[model samples]
Target: MFYICDERGVWPRRQRRPSDCSSQLVRVKLIGEVLAPFFLVAAFEPIGLWFTAPIAFAIYLSFLKHQHRTILYSIYFAFTANLLILYWSGAYVGVLPWVALSLLQTLYFLPIGILARFSNNIPLLISSILVMEEVKARFPFGGFSWTRIAFSQINSPLASIVTIGGVLSLSFATLLLAYLLITKKKSVAYVLLSLSILPSLVSVIQDSSEEKSLRFTAIQGGTPSKGLDFNSRAMGVLNMHLAESYRSVKGDEDLIIWPENAIDIDPLENAIVREKINELIKRTNVPLLGGAVLSEGPTNAAMLFREDGSIGSIYIKRYLTPFGEYIPLRSISEFLSPYAERVDDFEPGQVLKIHSVSGSKVSSIICFEIINDGIVREAARSSGLMVVHTNSATFAGTAEGDQQLAITRLRALEHNREIVSISTTGPSAIITARGEVIKSLKDGEIGSLSGEALILLKISISDYLGGFAPVITLIISLLWALSSMRRKDNN
Candidate 1:
């Protein structure tokens, strides 16, 4: 009988059993596959294990052995990763909704799973990830775009790709290097790594110029204690912002920006509210972009107040958050949970308004509006400065604020413009065009950020193309995969 030895061509002719060696390898591979995705979950939010993201994903892809188990494994991986990253959702809306949302995100990975099963080519797999993320960014009520692959790389070397092709480009380049490393394509990996260094070098050159700038003050008013109840105490919330506005004033600010919902009551309708806001603007002798809730069925808006307290143009929030702002399928949602009653149906603004504030064309995105690519694209095209006015008081103590800040950093790089993101209940920051956080206010703190920001009309290639890169790449990948499968079948 011929023996199949585990140890092949040993120096001393030592032989090992095939079953034991094969089983050991299989066990190691399985353990690696499972552990890889767990680490991927850490790539987001507070933990920010960003360096592990590409490596973890590469390991997961390496062990994708069976076509029949592709969907099952992918669902498991995506669900677990999303569940960990989005766990904070449970603190507000309950565990059920969080689980349901995580499950929904799994479908986004289904296509990538199928693609991985059919091909071993690295580029195709990377393209599949982009396609999955692109699809998930759009569906099910303007999709949950948090924890995108590129978001993990916000602080990494790959961030330089943002100015070139936006978030999708960074993701593609990272995955390319990751795949090459996993496949042991050392020569190609080294070459690509060298090329990756070029983007960061180019970014440094672009941001080196000292240009004209305007000094601005950003106010973060701590909520009347943190929780969902702060919104109920509208007057107190407004007073808090008013007080902070007074405290933050340095007397030299050319412009002042407040966090979203700074005025819980409509200033246009209330003389008392208008007077208080105008008082601050007048004292500072600077224009202020203050957030307010307008009561034509409650519109979330950022109204620009001139030095004399005269109202300039208003930029109302265009993308209203589905559950938080307006409960979808209200009747059904209310029946499911009592939390639905807490949210009033907020009307979305029809126009993407750009305001000329103190010589700078400002595109203000209120709160969650920063997540929408189209909204951000319009903002970049319309103005030289981008401001994200947000209130994270409800999600206080959670990683939601940090995650949002990370996304804002990506936006700064993507547009090659400075972003002043001011949030209530802390973590207000100033991000430069290079995606660097020059200044910041920590979460759960009451403070202000003062910085000099430049006005630049430069629009990135990614901004011009919008979602074209991912959509076009997705179509090409799917077609290529189909053609390859057909050729194999014919043979």
Candidate 2:
């Protein structure tokens, strides 16, 4: 839309208009820019075209020569990708909050595009994007660590290295492969191609130790109602879970776990509820770890019942759900949704709680806390087994529960520990150290999973050095950008 004035073209009549072909070319480029990130969205869950991220990035990189165009393209891509993948966010809450969230997250890409414009090196460009993802995963609250590029490759060939370096490692490997392929430098490409086969190599050399297994039941008690009002009848919700417990055919199960908010009323305070649970314990003849909303201001806690019928240590949920568990800036946020006012602020647990259920030591992660790096890593280091107690009742029909299950599968691989993820409304499963779902239940299915898992006492490298990989990558990216800028100045 800009024009150059020729010396003879001083008058408007003498000036020439740009060609229509140039305008048409701009339109074509803009269309491709928009489509690039659209394909990236398809690479995530539900549709799950896992290979599109690199292609999308390549298209994005093509725009870097024009800085203004690159910035606009990056924003458009980020916003579109987030909006598509996170459409489920608006399922419970309205569209406004969801759109706001997507827009806020898109801003993370703005600086990334600016930094990427400074460097043409494959490694630097790849590292900058990785660092951008890391920042988005850790800010403005406890962080929303959903739809990470690594999560898309749960079933990928390179999933094995997760034990050595965690999810960020998987992301790094994927980006590296993309870069090598694009460069088409046979030597570098061959090196990366060979490196990609190492997961199979590591699998051959890794310990295939056969440990004794412990039996556990992951209970999925259906909600009273399906949507946001699923827990409207709180006591009825408790009764439904209690009914599901009695209905469960107990085999030689060592322990039973219920999802978060299985018991809306605190069994500890109410003698009647306590007596009801005690009766179930006597009938099942097994200890249980189930979630409860305790009343000295409604703390989300895991109530552990001992085999001796005594109430064991209550493990409180450390990381509470940001808006759902407690609405931050309630006064300002109330405008976003009427449900904001409906949310009561629950206090975050002071300590990470790992308890012994019928002799097997299991760490409890309530709801979305399983997505947190520090919390999950701490639990994996200390405990032999891990359990995620979640209430997916709010997001029953959406892909949210399935996405959460995907995350749980990655966690099982990352920690190399057996995990029992029990949900309020289905997608419950018992996953092994190798990330296989031994047994699983579908969404909204009123069922319980009884399976055995080998208790892995060994911890992973990620357990020892949590979040360090991303931090190191971020520093390297900054240095690479600075070095590139310096070279340009010297020229």
Candidate 3:
């Protein structure tokens, strides 16, 4: 809309040369590819700028559409984003493990890039991303789901979509909105935007249902020190939890929970520790659920202590952290991490256990299990309340604790249940079914959070359909790919 006058004065404006347009397009793509990851990282903790997620994905998808060298650029974007998001993975260990883990995850993005290069079908691109996320979460020694985009949207209105189809649904909606934004499909984008708010409205209507409530206390006993040696003084960790429990419990709570690895010593094998826990339960006159490492099976488990000073239901951790709980490739892993050799391969539990406390069913998942979609969904299906036992002391000074707390909040929303998420050196919190934090303790603080938690037996649509969403997305992606190939052949 402007006149161009070069050597010839007062001349009419002319169209830009094809080469000039091509060069300008290339620059735009490069800029987007380089800057998108930073914005994506900002969307997650410890920055937690949730509104930036759509902007980040819009730029990323624009770069992907009809772009050459798509695979390389996609890898660059993924690696940069993952490296920042998972920096805590090697905070206590070293750089080798962190870099290696990030690279492994980055490989999953190659297919998305390749698919984008061939087809501009928005559904195909969105489905491919969801399928890759699901595959990455289950393969290569139980995949890490911490990098999923939906985890960063907890503070956004889009988060409410999780109640309909868990994290996968929210992720799909986010990508769709991003694609629409970049493609200038403003009309449809506005419609989807309006629909996204509907879930929140529905959630408010659902909350009016009357439900049973229980008084609970979550103890966050600060670790003796930060790093890999946080549990070196096993008794010190146990004593700190005991001291906090005694000082905080008001003798009126129905249940008390402790963080994972709080009792690093085997309470079953150690008579002293077992007797101490029993005495605490007896004195409190309340049911106690605490995590322990059993020496017999070398299993990481949550043991329930009854008010009568006897052990009750025991829920073993089904998902164990790789390289932390068990070494996958002993020789290679040891080379990558010096502390790898010191890590004992703990046995994974085959069963999911729900504890019954004062007529309410409670589900418990320990530490890294929070990221496993299937485990959390299955647990939420049967229980009214959720308890997360975690120990964030290993990556204490880093953003790991805050990131994990954010993930826990998302889970609370995914299932309509109140949660008690406790960590050893931690960002412990008592979260409501709406993903609101009723009470919390700061990192590296020795304290306890006591609150009233509702036992809502209502199962969310997400709890029922979360596991199936990925399979459905994968099927849709395959069908789209086949249809595109047929269209090309007909042409």
Candidate 4:
């Protein structure tokens, strides 16, 4: 039994052709690489099977480890997965922007694949993912963090880990689980799996009492139509929200919240709209916190209206949707989206505003801003309760709304704070600190959710350290890579 050795390790004389072995590897697992994204897609949104995420990554990482063309395979995997996860990006906009965005995002995976090809170090692989996520989140028009692995684990036992290390920690644990399972470390995997749920278990056993609570109403006023034109009937949208608030308010509520774009008309500029809003506040005698698009700066803001209809603290959205709210590269964007020319560039807010409503400090992030880790974490730290106002009318009839809800749930868990997620055109939910959806209105449903939201002041460990986790991971990974290369050179 003569033996041979090559870059892939030793094999019998009959199997000594490493090229043939590489070809065999590609041919045998090509289907797995192609289908791996489907499992990952299933782990998120409408088809939410949170457990499938690990299985999908195990398959994906296996290919990166053993395949000859890791970079190419990684591109294929990332592009396919992104296309599925971000299909809603093209719901109203044309396919050009959708495909273009997906391709651009896919490039972020190249570095991970390149690193994987260099070494199969577990910590290196895991840290590379965190680094990639962190970079993509800040680059190319304020990065998209929607497709993060932690968002997919909102329902899994791993979600509780987010409280300790934020989304990065949860993502680390998820990948660690996949690696452990792939390496057939069942006992260790089981131990990790059990330990992941310990936070939730402890939370349940504890008093879980609230220092204070607010009686609030979240209005999900359905749009007349769905698409880019959903708000074409801008005044109608505002009226619907007012109608819902009037119908839902029992006069005892401390605050009434509305989804983003609830007031497409500039309430300040339009006297009629202003009077109507003031009338709503006066009648309900409740502080009105709603999403409004102001004519000045053409800003997208969450406005807090006092009982006298005077505007209080306003949170102008810090992070705006790249192609949606504002068009970048005007001529090029117009070429891709015919409606791009109509988009007026909204100015980004420079300050973080936390509204004081009925003795409770309330924080909020508008629609797309919820995906921004720093903004979300800072908002959680500044206030006792958080509210997310989103308008999914553009991406209505798609999985986008559900996916945003999933992310919202994770944010709730990450900071251990109750979040009231209000979405125009449906799926408004009041999520608990533990990421449980206690009450919700379905998609396209015109209704309101009135509940007592606990004002929790306890800050999670993630709130304090989550922002630093990725940077730390990247530094450690680089140090390890350098050490590994030194050893290779010495040999």
Supply the TM-score for candidate 2: 0.88
Residue 10 CA error for candidate 4 (Å)?
9.7
The sequence of per-residue lDDT tens digits that candidate 2 reaches over residues 187-224 is 55765566468655655565567556678777787888
The clash numbers for all candidates, in the given order, read: 0, 0, 0, 0
| TM-scores, one per candidate | 0.90, 0.88, 0.91, 0.91
Residue 174 C-alpha lDDT in model 1: 67
Give a tens-digit lDDT track for model 4, residues 284-333: 89989999999899899999999888999899999999988888898998
What lDDT would candidate 3 get against the real structure?
0.84
Model 2: weakest 10-residue lDDT segment is 5-14
Q: Give the C-alpha lDDT of model 2.
A: 0.76
Residue 379, model 1: Cα distance from true site in angstroms: 0.8
lDDT of every predicted structure (CA atoms):
0.78, 0.76, 0.84, 0.84
- Candidate 1 has an lDDT of 0.78
Q: Between candidates 1 and 3, which one is better according to TM-score? A: 3
Query: Which parts of model 3 have CA positions greater than 4 angstroms off?
Result: 1-29, 120-122, 201-208, 473-491
Better of 1 and 2 by lDDT: 1
lDDT of 1 at 410: 90
